[model samples]
Target chain A: QQPVQSPQAVILREGEDAVINCSSSKALYSVHWYRQKHGEAPVFLMILLKGGEQKGHEKISASFNEKKQQSSLYLTASQLSYSGTYFCGTEYNNNDMRFGAGTRLTVKP
Target chain B: EAGVVQSPRYKIIEKKQPVAFWCNPISGHNTLYWYLQNLGQGPELLIRYENEEAVDDSQLPKDRFSAERLKGVDSTLKIQPAELGDSAVYLCASSPGGRWGNEQFFGPGTRLTVL
Candidate 1:
């Protein structure tokens, strides 16, 4: 099943921050985060695995809670470049994988 | 390395017509995936290929949708009798191997418009 994302959309000013959460009903082995700009392909941001592993950009980080089957992405001091639609993909082992609807974030100058 | 490649960035077809999208993953990538993205939504997986073998296609509309990854490098997704609802952006992504939740690279995608 697909993961669930909160805050369908968010708008923030430069230097502000935003948080996007993704949760799944089933057990999660890994969570992948991606960002897609207008008229472009989704770019890989980071991948968090079980055991609370977190990996991604310095300014952009995420945490994976294996017990809760959820991952939350934290964008600090948001920049105009960070404006885009963020998607969270969850994996239930190597074969089962799906993505959430996505969170649209707009960082205004 | 060159990123994933896809052909015909956009397509327009009348309802009930046939449409196809193609993708070429990064060289040596062993896993490939096709996903459909409706406007204002995240991509939904349509099929996944481990080499030339399709491993996950449960979400694909098998009745009218088909995909192929011959030679395990490039892939194609075809839809027959497409409906208006089929109008969406088809994205192709690829990963290096079976690494757990490895990062995937994506192609520009083909935006289909069914009128």
Candidate 2:
């Protein structure tokens, strides 16, 4: 089943922070995060396994709550380049990774 | 190394017509995936392949959709007698196989518009 993302869209000023959440109905084995800009492919951000581990890449970070079957993407001091759609892909099994509807994040100056 | 490559970046077709999208994954990546993304929504997996073998395709609409990754390399996804509901971005992604959560590198998707 597709995961559900909260706050369908969010607008932020440069240097601000924002959070996007993804929740799955089924138990999650892994959570993968990606960012997609308009007219471009989605770029890999990071992956969190089922251990409730937290990962960070640059100012972008993510946390996976294995028990809750949910994950959250945290963007700190957001930049203009961060304006894009953030997608959370959850894998309940080994190979099938299902994505949420996505949270549109726009960072302005 | 080159990222995943997909082509005919955009396609416009009428209902009942046929269309196909091609993808070349990153070198040595053994797992490839095809996903359909609607406007304002995240991509939904249509199929997954390991090498030349399709390991999962439960979400693919078998009636009019088909995909193949021959020789364990480049792949193609085709839709026959397409319908307007099929309009969306078709994305191809690949990851090095064998890990539980390998990061997938995606190709610039093919935006199909079925009229």
Number of the top-ranking candidate, with DockQ as the measure: 2
Quality of candidate 2's docking, in CAPRI categories?
A: high
Candidate 2 deviant stretches above 4 angstroms: A52-56
**Which is the leading candidate under lDDT?**
1
DockQ-derived CAPRI band for the predicted complex in model 1: medium
True contacts kept of 1: 0.79
lDDT for each residue of candidate 1 in B1-115, tens digit (9 for 90 to 100): 8999998899999999999899999998989999999999999999999999999999999989999999998999999989999999999999887554367899999999999
Give one digit per residue, the lDDT tens place, for model 2 in A15-74: 999989999989988999998998889998888887655444766778888878888888
- Please identify model 1 stretches exceeding 4 Å from their true place: B98-101
Weakest ten-residue segment in model 2 chain B by summed lDDT: B95-104
What does the i-RMS of model 2 come to? Answer: 0.8
User: Which pairs in model 2 have colliding backbones?
Assistant: none
Backbone clashes, candidate 1: 0
